[model samples]
Target: MAHPQPRTETSSDAALIRAWQAGDEQAAAELVARHARPLARFLAGAGAPDADVDDLVQETFIRAFRGVDRFRGHCQFRTWLLTIGGNVLKDFGRRAARRKVMPLDESVRDVTGDPHEHAEASEVEALLAAGLKQLPRLQREVFLLRAQQGLEYAEIAAALATTPGAARVHYHHAVRRLKEIVE
Candidate 1:
């Protein structure tokens, strides 16, 4: 009878990639588990509808796994995964544009006329969501990736297939516009 080799633990994502390439299914599962939540957060924060996020996230992993052999390890796995997420978002956006479905206005109403309370907060959130929708796609993506996902500019650049400098510029413009809308 043949015995399976024990899996080695390592901090390097490259190690995980090697293990995965060697047909260790656990390595693939670990990679997906590690990146899944952050990817979902990125999709949600980037304005994907609540109902579609899970589907999009699943699609991202499906695409990633299908192309796992082509992942050359030129970038960190997180960066690469986020790049895949961005591409998924782009595809979603294209489909949304074609469908021409306008997202519902998210204004939350309060029955009570309390001047300083939950209603104000809900109103602000609604306004912020609306303002975010007004931003150009690149700017909205950069802002959400940085602010919501806590991605550094370099990672944002990689995800967007742009330079870090451009990512910084987009973030700056997005912040400025959002501030104007809120204030």
Candidate 2:
């Protein structure tokens, strides 16, 4: 007989959102704890400055909770939260652009240990960052959602307000563009 699989916190994000909607404060905390890391990763991959990632995550959660009542469950809660994060990041970018103070060199974190490996990793990261920056907003968001967040095209479409077919096309275009840029 096969053993039953254990349930993970990831699978319960929707349940946590429901609990929070019902006025469960602990559930809100749990959702934040469960999603914070992934959201941070997504934000960083989308080119949020290292110094602003924590603030961006906080802002994303703030907006999500404030608009929680509007969440209609069309997508996963994490996807919805990330959609809010993308908007937050876009607004932040626009503000930074207006100030003519955009920063792109802050995404590479210092890695300890072997010097050669670190150099190679940093080079790849830089190339990817440059490539991502060149993509159109929809392609960038779709690529990050599908590639980095491991979301399905359907989930990405729901989050980005596009059709699944369009999401797939955007992701493919992003991949093709990145490959050309890298090569």
Candidate 3:
């Protein structure tokens, strides 16, 4: 009996992109599987209210697929996807800011815990979210991309449409501001 060899997972993103373009649906799935959680984390940590995180992640993938032809491999695929995600977040924030009727999510208090502990944790989280909201969008994105997403300065720069040097500066400023916030 002949047995098939197991496939290796060493394919570069470029190769995966090519495969996806050639109608190999698994390649798209692989890309999404590899990146989706990180995108969600980045979105959440970058000031996306928790309720909107999943939708924003889905929208980022949708936009990336639709605009894949414009991707020139000038940077890593994850970097390009973060750029798309960042744009989506910016647009969402703008629309949200314009709409004064937006209602806050009422489900958070449903969790089981000592009310005082939960309230304290919620207050701290709200303060951190507010601090992130106060940062210039670039600094916030750079900080989350580097600190939370574990991207290198060059990758963060590419994702945020800036120089690596500028990314470093943004990260420093963000850290200082966030420390001021938490302290």
lDDT string, candidate 2, 11-107, tens digits: 4776777677778787789888989999999898888988899999999999999999898889988999999999999999999889998574843
| Candidate 1 error regions (>4 Å) | 1-11, 97-122
- Candidate 2 ranges beyond 4 A from true positions: 1-11, 107-110
Greater-TM-score candidate between 2 and 3: 2
Q: How far is candidate 2 from the true structure (C-alpha RMSD, Å)?
A: 5.2
For candidate 2, the lDDT comes to 0.87
Instruction: Please give, for residues 14-96, the per-residue lDDT of candidate 3 as tens digits.
Output: 87887778787888888898899888888877777777888999999989988899998877898889878989998888889
Q: Candidate 1 or 2, higher lDDT?
A: 2
Give the best candidate by TM-score: 2
User: Which candidate's lDDT is highest?
Assistant: 2
How do the predictions measure up, each by TM-score?
Answer: 0.75, 0.88, 0.82
Give residue 93's lDDT in candidate 2 (0 to 100).
95
Indicate the residue-level lDDT of 7 in model 1. Answer: 56
Candidate 3 stretches with Cα past 4 Å from truth are 1-8, 101-123
Expressed as tens digits, the lDDT of each residue in 1-183 for candidate 1 is 966556555546777777787887888888877888988877766667766888998899888877878787655677677668878988998898899975544443224555567567767876777788789888987888788878898877766679999999999999999999988
